[model samples]
Target: MTKNNAQKKAARLHQAANRGTPFPSAMRAVDTRLPAAVPGTPWFRERKRRLVCYCCGHPNLIASFGDEREDTARFELYCENSGCDAREIAVIALSGNMIGTSSRADVRTLTHFPQSATSHRTVNGRYDDWLAGSEPWVRTQRGEDFPCLWCGEMDSRLSQNDVATDRSRFHLRCLNTSCVVREYAVLIVRDGTLGTADRPDVMAIQYIDTPPSSRRTPGDASYDFVAMQRVLDEDDKLARRRSTGPIDWSAATRIR
Candidate 1:
């Protein structure tokens, strides 16, 4: 987008930002990439405001957005809870170049992007640095911000033996004794946002699983009838010879 057109988009979005302006110091937050930096004006930080559906608080996929070009972004937030399928549109303008700073180094760098995702959290990189950067890590070297999904325990601590290589992995363990949490990796929940003990807007880890005794649909011929018959036959054989103990109905619990 041209600098002039970018400026117009910023202006319109600026109005929305002004309405919900956060009470922080104003700072320009985009790389204009212009030939020369503008001087003598104080930089106005880009304002961020999210529009989610009132019916449902969370949206399904942010993977879709409109005009996601450089300067301004217009996007639709979709919520799919209980087949509601509600949507809320959102707009935000990015400011390029600090108003008064002649050099880029003089202004605070603002990174505008979401965190990357991975199929497995066990991969190695500076992600350890990011995951370990939570408030709990600084205060007590724990992973309270991104708790272990298995144990639901947040006493996360880094491995003591990591050599600190770029691709070297950062391992975390849950402190719970009865739980099965161990050395595992982390997942980025939010990029460019620091999570604290009070607010955990950072990385996390979760495990997905299914029980082996999951129920199948009734009258479904796709099931293994031979295996079911074999089990029934085995039970018949056991019933013929079993006299070791009497039935104890009180010890058994009903599924329903």
Candidate 2:
């Protein structure tokens, strides 16, 4: 097929899949390219907003199409959750060159988009420096403002800022309200002198991941009685087996 025909076919396939239709061929693949950077301003620091899964709250969503071009960008994304088939389309307009800035963004998502899916967690290039041990790292005092990895907002605050007992290590958290995901980074000072234990010249930085949140959708309140009945039946069988005081290991065989 021609390039234009392939693009049209991909769009048709996407629409059919959204409508719960089976694909004509399992070998067919969508003619889409992965975006090199997050959709937003041209600056890397401005790419702060991420498309999250609305149904499962997954951080990574696969982009179907839409390249960030001109002052406006459109993103077509699908959930990474195997059990959930949530798809979303978002359009972002850059007002003053950055997203999730101090003035916020003029971005807009689909009406069905849940608030939980709008995450401000974005890591642009800071992590690369952490790995390369780049020089002139951020130096800060306790409770002061620092560059945030997630929101990229200028008004980000640093807390839990204190030097460790080792005198060479320090730690702090990005308490920026604009960012949904909390950021905690470990730092080490080359001078090994944490004067007054307040200010530290960070030489090396390490990013720490936050705890995983619940994947269950907030809107799903109703339980599947049929699935629940199956679970109860399984529990009863397990209870009967436990009544023997221990599981019979000799009879246990791996199922292929």
Candidate 3:
């Protein structure tokens, strides 16, 4: 499908998730946070391009803390620009793809009244379980036989089948969210770097599956030799550029 078509379908899926919900709370529980990338992931060792911040144009904004969930590592990227209080969370599979909203560009506001606790919307879950239960809601792959993923029960409301990604390819969902998997973030990674808006180096990359890749041709096997060499040549380049130091941009006044 064309980019425009994909976007429209994604919006519908989001709507369906909310409209046909048997469990709104569960949906919230599932789709909230962004996971991080770590050593165990497939791409971590491969050395793709550095993950730059799409929001404020900051490069390598990720901070990784060894959380308990080995399968699902959590990565938090906060834009500490004086007035730009945008932040994002991401979840990375052991295999190395950024699943769900971690792949999204539009950000959630880091909650704090000029200076307070930034309300994080990120939710964490066991990686394997999440991966196994929630298969990609692809029409070509799994959409033919399965009913609507959102409701799990086909109501008259979910008569049509149109899927889309958001304005950016950050997330994809049913034109209407039924109840479950339709409204979800598409796994967006390209050339080893996590893809985001306006970043051509990684944009338009094929969606790489977190688990075993099904496509025989060009699975998650591609990498940028130039970028990889940079990783080896300047081992501390990324580390020095993206320090996980405590971020306290609270003092930076917000401009209306």
lDDT of each: 0.27, 0.30, 0.27
Q: Pick the candidate with the highest lDDT.
A: 2
Candidate 2 yields a Cα-based lDDT of 0.30
**How high is the lDDT of residue 70 in model 3?**
28
Q: What TM-score should be assigned to candidate 1?
A: 0.19
Cα error of candidate 3 at position 193, Å: 28
The count of backbone overlaps in candidate 3 is 35
TM-score, ranked from best to worst: 2, 3, 1
What candidate 3 gets wrong by more than 4 Å, as runs, is 1-39, 42-50, 64-69, 80-83, 92-169, 172-256
- Model 3 Cα lDDT, one tens digit per residue, 1-256: 5654544455456657767432222222344342343334322223332443332234543433321122222232333333222333332211112333223221111111111111222222443111111221232233333222123233212113222322122232333332323333222222111222223211211111111122223333554234544333223222221223332222122110
TM-score for all predictions?
0.19, 0.22, 0.21
